[model samples]
Target chain A: MNPIANRYTELVGIDHPIVQEGLGPFRTPKLAAAVSNAGGLGTVSMPGMPTDLDAGARTFREHIEECAALTDRPFAVNIPVGVDNNGVVLPFTDIYIRTVLDARRVDQSLAAQLTVLTTSAGFPGDYIGMIKDAGLIHQHKVGSTRHAVKAAEAGVDVIIAAGFEMGGHAPSKAVHSYVLLPNVTEAVDVPVLLTGGVRDARGLASALAMGADGVAMGTRFIASSANSDWHPTYIQAILDAKEGDDVAFDGVYGPCRGLKNAASLKLLNHQEDGTGEVIDAVELTRWKIESMQRAQTTGDVTDGLVLTGQVAAAIDDIIDIAHFVPNMAAGAAEILRGLASALPDTEHAFS
Target chain B: MNPIANRYTELVGIDHPIVQEGLGPFRTPKLAAAVSNAGGLGTVSMPGMPTDLDAGARTFREHIEECAALTDRPFAVNIPVGVDNNGVVLPFTDIYIRTVLDARRVDQSLAAQLTVLTTSAGFPGDYIGMIKDAGLIHQHKVGSTRHAVKAAEAGVDVIIAAGFEMGGHAPSKAVHSYVLLPNVTEAVDVPVLLTGGVRDARGLASALAMGADGVAMGTRFIASSANSDWHPTYIQAILDAKEGDDVAFDGVYGPCRGLKNAASLKLLNHQEDGTGEVIDAVELTRWKIESMQRAQTTGDVTDGLVLTGQVAAAIDDIIDIAHFVPNMAAGAAEILRGLASALPDTEHAFS
Candidate 1:
């Protein structure tokens, strides 16, 4: 095993350094539990209910309870705080955070097992004190080194360097993982979890070599059996993709990378023609809710956009969690070992 | 737009199909003359002894003399094939080819007008037949499908698919343009030229888009005052590359890709690991000669390995070509004419 392996293992208390991203609506109790049980961190996204903070809190609590029942291993919850549709406040920021904290206070079992809380899409500096006070590790997703530095200063436990290749709403500024990972890792003292365009063992090896502690995969896990209900066509499209198939489109807030299908083409055209103006928070919420409902319930890939990472290019096949998680770990370990063995001998060898 | 524009238009008869492959020692004055004077072809290879029976008759004839004296149209000669030790074979190939054909028997002035003869590796391919043959055009060198196929099959008249990514021995297999362009365009029936990795607009746009009639390039071309050698680091690396960067070992005979580096990994490695041996001829050559040599010559990019055409990865920055070779000629013409305004009757159209 490589030295980074031991360090990552110690940091995450897992056999491998693979972390599954929190895919909202797609993230279910079973999926989270399966990833956690597979010896990697799994995260569940807090449920949102438009403007009704109380209702959203209730949904989140129930979801948390379900995830707790599914796995005995540690997992996390992702809270996204940012501007919403209609320019009106969504209230998910404070409501969701307080709900998680309140739930931790009331449920001893949940508090004991929930190992991490991931904050994404917006700054988490304000909530770091609350999260640490509750004794949970904090992970933040950052698109640039500046964001990473900010996260580090805010006491983020792990920094996820999300590059432009990532699916869903990625930062508009374009910085690839190759350039971003090294820069961010060098700047921050915290352990870095590299995201975006990482799909296989080779990618893992490369990232570790570049100074990342672990990899967080979104698209790869989404294609697994745990996500069987995901539209088969979308899944197949991802599987068939070669490296450069995807194109990023301007989303409501930023850029989102997905399959270049008719809907996406329409969105791109809209951006180009300057006709698709930004909808406010309420309108955005309704639009997303409707789109997700159409997509998830009806299996309309065109209606519901799938969030994926650039690593989708390498995912030619999908397997069960039981097989995938272990294979990923083993493959990385083997490559790392080979790389280490090839290195020139040092004075500390065997001593 | 660019200075090369007038030269390109004059050299290639048809608006967009004319190109030259940067061949090496194999490049001959007759070959360049045959292509350029034909009004459709241009070629460039190494400026050494013409190898082969036909070249002997054409000996003492310089690339410039043969090409310029043959035709007034634009033509070019590539000289970088002599940079490495393997280039020794270039003179031999040139001598043999020149000897077999009585090139001296032909009109020397007519031969001097040959347009282009791309050169790379040991020597250019023996092209005395096409040069001396009736109505034959010649162009050579390629990097990928975008580089070779159009030239090969379009009958535009010579094609060279070179795959040295940055410089050095071409990869034995996983990353050379030889394997990529050929495999993708094997159906082509025209003359195919091969060169190492080229460095220019004419090279980039032509090869990546598969529209070149032939290729003529030199890393040193950019270092010219007439050239734009983007970076000093890139220029020095190309000049310093060795035979290894240009040679392949264990080649299966066809083509391969990759750069020379410590890993020495090839596409063959993925074919079948059970036997612990390579099973394909093409793959073997790619690793041994092409990829290995490329690594040695390119420096740190030895790991960078300069093999392109698994394109879809944004590996190269796009440079402007003096000429525009539309991928779809008819469609481009229609768009250029603003035919949308001339469409009759229906304001609405259905696919």
Candidate 2:
């Protein structure tokens, strides 16, 4: 008897609906494995794109294998489908999707553990059928109701509704979770997981109340004890963040939410007045990716790009995934029950 | 046995926790009265600032009187406290506050009906004492947890935690409800009402689940049939709104959310590059007010400022306040109970 068992948990064969979502351009195999072993779904994030597509794919494969080796329970892999101006999928996205499929095809045990493939940043148009054919649950992350509907209609197994307050790459339309969740949930019949501004039991309960099946968190999981792959300084910055410490700046994607540090401020200033030193579009994109990796690898939180959600301001303590995941589900259940019982029996008066 | 009875309903003396929040610069006496009659809190919005300070106060007084006359139930008045560059309370804010206090002093009946006063825009500083001394429930709307703590410490009876997606004047710090509500509720002992991006039962349930005592809606109520004070075209504009149709612009206060029409585009264009023809600061402020007023009075949805929340995308039909208010509360309670029952009894396993 799981405190929170729903379509999401059943579909992925996990004990709880809690998910450690994609924290790409950073190493997250250990964090992913910890969450999965704790009975929640963990996701192996894509590594930073390199000049050689095969090199990027190999790194992504290694992370997935590391997570699979650590956790016997089901987990996921997140590949952001980067597209060019012409809507053609980028080489990195193409290679990474293949890497996951290739790894699973070779090893039966690895295939059983890696049961979900989540795509974001752009539509997983052609790759949707390919992923579905691989017998993996295909979850596409979208920021708008229209996109949610489009992805659902296109046979995507799940929809992770991304809000403007989410860290790293955010939706271009800027709809916040309060509005976006209900809209997306109402528009599609697929299981909806809210991704943005979610931290604890209250967030999960709120997501469930708004018709979301689960919550996929990035910033919260990043601050957890299991996430030792990232630099401790990055976690400290998240813990020390106060209100208005984060800002949305131009990224490889349309808009990205991150700490308002020297790197992000420089990007913001350049976006506003076009005053920063001239860099080509390709060079700038590569530089942004490298900056994000630097923060995670070298603990350079000041000059390096620190991607985080607005909810980071409220997160103060590091959590242990083993206790936190199941406890979160139990807490949400208690809260929902308490709220229900608290409401007076006004059906006679109203009805 | 009210469907949604809580600290908010108990503190405010309303049957349901639902609230028809402020729709300022527009008339809403009839809409407010209808909500009050339906056992929810109704708020009489502040009229636009006029060249004649006394006349503006008079208009506000008349609106309050009209709402009181329509409903014997307790109602509220929303006045945004405007401050000058030196932080001195503006003449209009001073006049409006006195106008409500004076109205009650002169007429006991009006005092009995108008039991609440909600202040937004700036901190209620000196006016908090005045509002509490008047025996009115003082609910100060804030966007950050710091402000909520400050207002609660200052003795505000209630705190309406406003999110970034709210219509009209938004908070200077762009904290969305997903991140803002739980933070504000945790920071203060006073009852917190979630305002912004809320509509219908799911929104109410989500608000309550996130530790909010209730929900305060502006855009949802604006599209109601009771809101006849606003032009039908204005209502139609809200009905026609879709995802990505609303934008936040430089407002009279910090920022304002509204439909992306000619007037808003003009303001946004000017804000970006300062390319719009130079106008005196005072004159520009006056124009923005007049434009907002024009949309309400005349059917000028095209050129006038059509203030609305991001939730307008999901609001396609006009609701009747008589049924919508109480039904919304009941629906939320039912949903909460249903969700509580649906969860598996995994308490033993988790514990």
Candidate 3:
């Protein structure tokens, strides 16, 4: 048994203290199920999901069923509330609440598999009560300690402390994980999951050492074969990426970090909401989702916003998802053992 | 006996894989000595050292003697070249060369104790020859991997990689430690010491886990008994500081991170360099040094630019310098031990 177990694994009933965070609309289904099957909880993301609510709900239901069919292990469904889908302000909260209720009505076992519901992009204020009522283990992503505290106060089951290094739509506060994780972990009683800049077992071990209960990795997972759904060229981009290749840009929602490509540069130059974007009030929601899909589906790597983190610099290989998390955990264990043995002798010598 | 020994300890003859980075002008002597005696290398800093060359040299000599008297262990002297102190463009490179030669002339044993000469703030090409001729270990600080590679190419013995969260003058690249460290560590063959956002043993352990040979800390040491030379009120301000209290300002050198006190806020609003600096290149160089000193010795935390880092959020109490590094290293060891036991079992269970 990996000694890396923590409150996160116990709370979510997983074997490992790692989480695959939700990507934008259409990032999971197969990938999410693969992560869950590997003993670490996987997440199916639909941030600003479904341009058409009813049709999107049907798709969401189908995706949930597909993941359930693939893995018996626990998984999560990510819904970024308060995002505008172009001119249509997506009723993401309502869709999320209804999706949970409807999934349970359709199949209780499938509903049970969704051990957690993760929200990001905007304040989950109006939807907390409804989320709790749906009996979902709620996890809210925050970029600063203040936001984490607010989420905890509002009764979020877990706080995901994401730093400025995170890809996709990040918290606007720009607090880094190294500083923000400890502050959030100390400020809240709930288990804190460190997000952003984590790639392997070393990162996992480091997070555990720094008061985080676990870690949530997005970019690392994106580089694996499990994420075959994402463009192969995109994965290659990540493997080839170096420091400074990833940059922050104002997308349709808010601050997004990704490997610099043609789409992101255009987004950066766009006039509007790069600074104080109310993700929910944005009218270009549909365009944003489609752009990511274009990036994901288009064989071309530079066409869509390829969301990623700075940790992309460290990713050099793509592996099977089943082997990815386990191998990383083992490598981290070896390093820890060496340090443990080495540290004691040094301590004694000093004493 | 300490298994934690690395190239850093071997290079400098210290017991622990930790370094006390030179804080800006007016730091060290006692602090440096305390750190060296505690088994980690300590550094006496001199950035924009003194406008008065003669008096500055006397004071510098006196401080070095004091450190030698306090501990026979190896310590370091830091000189940041290309800085203007008041109306004087301090001949820092010249002063550093003369100081090293003079120190050797005065007392050969004292010269032996000065095991390392660290440089930062500007290109070190001109002074590398003098450093090499003196037979002292050479270390250079950099904010980016490109700079690290450059310094490594220059044949520096070590590279001190700093992240954006570091206090005093920081890298203008703004790349963070999590991203920058691995890039630099992978890009260069020389030993790398991580700086910024590290406050305790956990940070030290984390740095080692991430390819760094050792760790360096400045802000963490600032809130310590060893740093009594810094105003009590300024230290108190760090203890009392809430998240977001620190801000980045373009001071004399480049970007500087410090607590946002009245002086800092005024600087923020000023013209070119903030504080109405005009940034005319000439008019502002002198103003930056005085502002920092005013903040350092005035006993008024609000009046001076109180240099600090994001780690200030993690610091809750002051400590004795002698005990600070050792206790931190031990604490880190204990954490690593627990993880080692915990991780191996999990890996075996999964495997």
Best by TM-score: 2
**Which one wins on lDDT?**
2
How would the docking of model 2 be graded? high
Q: Say what the interface RMSD of candidate 1 is.
A: 24.5
Model 3 CAPRI rating: acceptable
True contacts kept of 2: 0.92
> Candidate 2's residue-wise lDDT over B1-351, tens digit each?
478888889888899999888988889899999999999999998898888988889899999999998999999999999999999999888899999999999999899989999999889998999999999999999999999999999999999999999999999988999999999988988899999999999999999998989999999988888887888999999999998999999999889999999999999988877778998989999999999999988979999999999889889999998999889998999989888878787344335
Model 1, B248-270: lDDT tens digits are: 22222234333333433433333
Question: Model 1 off-target regions past 4 Å?
Answer: A1-4, A84-90, A228-234, A240-244, A276-285, A342-351, B1-351
Listed per model, the TM-scores of chain A against the true chain A are 0.89, 0.98, 0.90
For all predicted structures, in order, the TM-scores are 0.53, 0.98, 0.88
Report the Cα lDDT for candidate 1. Answer: 0.52
What is the i-RMS of every prediction? 24.5, 0.8, 3.5
Candidate 3 C-alpha lDDT tens digits along B6-39: 7778878988877888786765788888889888
lDDT of 3 at A111: 69
Clashes of each: 133, 1, 18
Q: Could you tell me the TM-score of candidate 3?
A: 0.88
Global lDDT of each candidate: 0.52, 0.92, 0.78
